[model samples]
Target chain A: MFVTPGYAQETAPAEGELQTEIVHEEGGEAGFPPFDTSTYPSQLLWLAITFGLFYLFLQKVVLPRIGNILEVRRDRIAHDLDQAARNKEEADAAVAAYEQELADARTKAHAIAQAAQDAAKADAEAERKSVEADLEQKLVEAERRIAIVREAAMKDVGTIAEDTAGAIVEALIDRKPDDAAIAAAVSQVR
Target chain B: MAEDPIHQFQISRLIPIEIGGLDFSFTNSSLFMVATVVTTGAFLYLTTSSRGLVPSRTQSVSEMSYEFVANMLRDATGPQGMRFFPLVFSLFMFILVANMFGMVPYFFTVTSHLIVTFALAMVVMLTLVGYGLKTHGARFFKLFVPHGVPGVLVPLVASIEVISFLSRPISLSVRLFANMLAGHITLKVFAGFVTTLSGLGAFGVIGAVLPLLLTIAITGLEFLVSFLQAYVFAVLTCMYLNDAVHPDH
Candidate 1:
């Protein structure tokens, strides 16, 4: 619907001038504009010039700039990605080292615990053995004393028996017996 | 008047100049060609001036265009084919910008002309042939011969290949020219209908709405065609360059 001023002005006198313009066109003043050979030289020349200039501009200036920008961006992204990968690798290594250290500490703690337990068990066994030996020695000493006391009591019993016998004889005969005889009589009775 | 759709394509001399007794007067087509070049060059240069690691919106657009063409060329021709990147990129941007400029109501479409498109196609063809010969010497003609063909039919197949190879520029040029020419004419005709109908009474005004809607739709389609044609031209150039690079296959 938008018409340029030139078109509007041309169409303004359309009722009268349109027929004349058609006549003028039919009179072989001009043919189809595209088929007209006269314009080819200028069009080709200008096309060559402009297209040549455009090609040179693009090849020399525009493309390389854009290519450089894209190349730079690609490199930057690659570098950033590489840095990120390296950082991740380092973090993974750190985590592995931490886990290894944790495992080593856990093994060391287990060994220390095992050693302490063994030492405590050995100490308890040694103490128990020493106590048992002391108890055995005390029992032997007590048995020796009891055996001596029993022998002494046995000697006294013999003496008392002989004295009884002597006292009975003395009542009857009114005399005391000899000590060696009493001992020999006691020994014969044993 | 908008009544004559062809009126828009007429090239009038802006500043007439004669060089070497030739009709080298600068026409409107030339003007728009220069405009397309300037626009493409300025846009690319200014947008990427900052060279930001993180691109701005305009810079992103410029970078996207570069990558798009680079990827297209690389895909078609591989890394060795990348030497033709400047030519391919220039052709794509020129055609695209020129077509877009044509979409403006009163602006001349440089690519709508057969001479221009033909010239552009020839440029590509010449580059292909020149590079092929320079790199492969007499072996460049192998492009016309398929890899595995009957020995008896070799001449026939090779001739057919040569014909097709020669028709590349014509087909490429005509395709773009015809598309632009037909699309613009259709749009102008439909828009002219709207104008003619609106000149009638109220019922005619109501009828004009349909064509107005169609004109809008076709204009949108034309924009798509413009970009599509540019991409087709560039991609085809890449494919042709591939043939030049690896003629045996």
Candidate 2:
């Protein structure tokens, strides 16, 4: 607020008097137009009307519309996120179910294979037992045959020794050994 | 004709209507005020009426302004300040339009008037007081007391703070009024200079060019001032309201 003293361009005949009157008419006496109190009520009233209507309009219509748009956008974003999470969870559950089914199938396949392996082992054991039984029967028959041959050889040896002893007695001293004596001597030698 | 720059500010009655000694005659200021409101209202309404997901240009501008003031309020007073968004937003838009509208040749600058701006400042101050009292009860008085003041200095500091607090409306109103008044008066004085200088024949035309260019430059500056003053007024209102909301020294 620098008050520029005064200058005159109108309603003057001389510079000094015109300057004073200019100050008197417009510069000083007129006051700052804004500070003029008489116009306060009307300006204030209009301001009140304008500002009040504006505030109400904003609060009631304009702001709410903008706010609603923003809010709707935010809610949409949140909803999309929630839906994506739900989809992810469902996918995870589906993967879990698929893995569980695979595991069950593997267990069942293993059980079936194990049963086949056990049956094969049992069949091999039975075949080995039968073969052992047949070999034992054959060994028993051969041992019996050898025992018969030994008995025949023992009877022949007794007969041959009796004949030789009779010949030797006739030739040496005109005497022959009896059957019971020969049998006793051969038995002692065997 | 001697150009009287002061005559431009004269408040002539356009439609004189006196009610019980009250001069509520519809004046030029009132006309511009209505124009500001209607223009603001219509622009906002048309732009936002679509509410498109991807905003149009006008919608973008409106939304930017809305968010700008909203953020300022929120920054100053926290989330609690959002309740006063309509108040702050309207003041900002109203003053901004009024100031800018005044820059037009032969238009009334409503914000340039002391009575108008003072009323606005009073609205801000009274709203602060009313809300402060309502929200904090008697604790709002704590704003006048400095938090870390020594016991000996408390009274002095408190008195100063109280005076500062009380002067908010005066300073707030005057700061805007003075700036607007000065800018307009300077512009008019220069405009008058251009005419007066050109009246002195060929040599005077050469002299008149400088004031003409300067007036253009100042006109641009006034445009900026128009926006800056509105921004400052709104920011100060936010700060004062912050004190009311928090009221902590």
Candidate 3:
């Protein structure tokens, strides 16, 4: 800041001069502004009035609104956070429940499938055993029939041979002629 | 130096005539006061008008002022005191601007004048009285009589309390006026010393240097005092307002 040389010089007393007397100049003190005492009463009155009005405005208007806004904002945030947490928990529970149900269904299906396989295996085993028993009985009966048929065939062959031998002997004896017929009959009888 | 001190204080001459035997020299001081009021009013109006979520620079300054007063009130009167924030804020701003503007070379420091300070003090006092009366009615008289004092001490205590009550205006006014007046006078004296010493020969130049530095330092200090004084005035006003509102406490 630049000082005006003229203004500074005007206020400066002569060097080495200690003057107690305040020079009351015609136009006011050299560099200082004049003081006004008149507005004191008015200023003070206005101060009180304005202060009162301002207090009234703050009490009635500003504070309540600000307080309400803050309270509402806090409540909303808390509510939102709480709701979000609840939804998450519920979702987690639902997911767990679904997973459990899915596992249970799989277990039930496996049990049903295992039960069907077991039944099929058991039935096949029972049928195979019954067929084996029936075939074994049929094989025994066939062997017995073959044995009886062979015995009967053997008896019939013996009887037929006897009959032929008797006929030959009788022919030989009765005919008395041919030596060859009589010898052949004796040999067949022996 | 001017012969008449009155001429120094002349604000201006409007229709140059005596009104009711009072010489009213409408001087430069008067013009500055008018300017101060207009500027203060306009500044406040512009700053507060928008009241946006994000404040403009002007608005931020105003908001800071509001916070300063709010904190002061809160400290003095607790959370309940928040209701009085605007009054305290306005008091601080008005006085602060007036005090600061007076620091300019040609401006009149309104707070320096006894009459101005007295009026301001009287307003604070009257509000305390009026509000107390309005709220407490007849019981407001009992403010002088403290409970649990001995019967013999009542009269003396009451007398002393009355005097103390009456002294509020004087104390409030004188504190501001005296501080401002003393500070300005000291500045003027130092300024004179610097100028006079600087004018002398070689050694005088060095002598002037210290005084010049001191003046610079004093000026900065005075700036702080100006703001501090305004704040003290407003805070005291709030304290008084609190007393008025809650008389029993």
Any residue pairs clashing in model 1, and if so which?
Answer: none
lDDT of 3 at A169: 61
Candidate 2 residue lDDT tens string, B37-156: 989988888899999877889998888899899999999999988899999999999999999988987777888888899999999999999999999998999998868889999899
* Local lDDT at B131 for model 3: 72
Better of 1 and 2 by DockQ: 1
**DockQ class, candidate 1:** acceptable
Give the per-residue Cα lDDT of candidate 3 at B185: 70
CA deviation > 4 Å runs, candidate 2:
A1-31, A77-190
Tens digit of per-residue lDDT, candidate 3, span B1-249: 322222223333322434565544433334444555557656755665665555688866755666677778887777865555655665677678878986777455656666666766776788678878987897787778777779999999989988988887889888887888778777767777877887798889899888798888988888999999998898888887777766665
Against the true structure, what is model 3's DockQ?
Answer: 0.09
Supply every candidate's count of residue pairs whose N, Cα or C atoms clash at under 3 angstroms: 0, 0, 18
- Of the two candidates 2 and 3, the one with more favorable DockQ, higher being better, is 2
Docking level of model 3:
incorrect
Name the candidate that leads on TM-score: 1
Can you list the residue pairs that collide in candidate 2? none
Ranking, TM-score, top scorer first: 1, 2, 3
Question: Which residue runs of candidate 3 sit more than 4 Å off their true CA positions?
Answer: A1-190, B2-18, B77-87
